[model samples]
Target: MSEKRDMSRSRKLFITDKLMRLLLVGAASTSVLVVCLIFLFLFREAGPFALNPGLGKLLDSQWIPVSFQEEHFGVGPLLAGSALVTALAMLVTVPISVLVSIYIAEIAHPTEREFLKPFIEILASIPSVVLGFFGLLVVAPLIKTTFGLSTGLTALTGALLLSLMAIPTIISLSEDALVSVPYALKNASLALGASHLQTIFRVTLPAALPGIVAAVMLGIGRVIGETMAVLMVTGNSAILTASPLSSVRTMTATIAAEMGEVPFGSVHYQALFWIGIILLVITFFLNIIAQRVLKKYGMMK
Candidate 1:
């Protein structure tokens, strides 16, 4: 009787553990389902825009959705503008953020690093609207004056603000990567007559390459998806141009700016959904690339 009772108790514990695991898996699967549902709905609505031949005009520099009367459905300009702004922001952000991360992780005194880290994280906690407001009031005017921009809002203005926003995330993630570098490896590099900087570049960074890549990818995703601040500062012109000083519109801005006014089932409304699809695709690719890079570099281990 005693042995039978013990076995029953053991089976109950096993069942409980399996049940918990099943619940966790179900939760994750449900979350993925929700995401897939969103993608499906976006595409369903965007089908008209995708099917329209006027998509060519939407890519054109001039976006007078009303002037032509016949209607136009161009997305190329918005897509290109968003890409350019995000690229510029990444250019400005990645180096500064990585360097800062290195300083905090590998060089700074513990007390000072601890004190500063939270402040950096606080930047991420700030709402997007506040950042947009800051850009409108402060950065936009500064850009107008310093660069002679006709309008305070331009691609450069948005890029600058977005770069600032990207910094906290990049710094936080890169610092974690730097911290994860094996101490023995650092010591070995130093023992071989390598200076701290050389050791960092040669040994520590390479080992943490995956995490750094992940950090940059995440930053790109943030910049590409950012709506409020970019909408406020990117001039929202929906015109494609090479000049950073000129006004531009990003995919996110187009949806945010136009969706409300566009009548339901209208071509323009469908086009906005297409823009969402594009944004989703861009983000998905970035994440997949980051994952592949991490795996290739053995960082996942």
Candidate 2:
């Protein structure tokens, strides 16, 4: 009688486990389905323009779509602007974020870590529009006066504001990554006569490199997708230039600023959809690269 009861219990547990596994699989599949639907919608909407616009014209630098007689839909300027702003933002964010992470993870006392962690979380919670307003009202004027530029609305202004927004993400994730390094490895380094800073540089940081790369990639993704702050302070000029002082517009800002004005089914509307496709492609690749790095480094299975 006891053996029969035990067998029945085992069977019931197995059934329950199988059901849970099926439920989890369904949940995972739903996310993939949603992403596929979004890509389908974008391609469907942009198909007309993508087919009609000759490749050479589409790649041109000019982007005047509102002109009645001559409407151009070149994406070169928007892509350049996005690249410039994102690159500058990363330059400002990466070093400061890594240093802050190192201090918080390896150097800060428990009490200080508690305070700093919450402060960084609060910084991340602040609304993007509010930051944009701050940029326009405060940072913009400072830049204009300090640089003696005609206007504060330039790529540098946008990059600075985007960096402010991205710092919290980079710092928090990077600190977590640094903290995850094994205490054993650190102790071993110290036993070998390495100083605390040396252990962090040579032992902990190497083990945590994958996570740091992932953090930076996530920060770049965040900055690339940001719209309100960029639109508010980037001067909205669709001009191709590498100089940080030059006014520029990004792909995200283009969609946000002009989507409402463009007529439905028009070529301009279709072009905006094409831009969405481009953004989706960029984000997808970034995530894939980050995941590959994590997998290669044995940080993720």
RMSD of each: 2.9, 3.4
CA-RMSD of model 2: 3.4
Instruction: Rate residue 267 of model 2 by lDDT.
Output: 86
In the range 204-265, model 2's lDDT, one tens digit per residue, is: 98899999999899889889999999999999999989999989999999999999998898
Error of 1 at 181 (Å): 1.4
Candidate 1 C-alpha lDDT tens digits along 123-145: 99899889999999999999999
Q: Candidate 1, residue 124: CA error in Å?
A: 0.6
- In model 1, the runs with Cα more than 4 Å from the true position are 1-24, 51-62
**Whole-model lDDT per candidate:** 0.87, 0.91
C-alpha lDDT of candidate 1 relative to the true structure = 0.87
Badly placed stretches (over 4 Å) of model 2 are 1-27
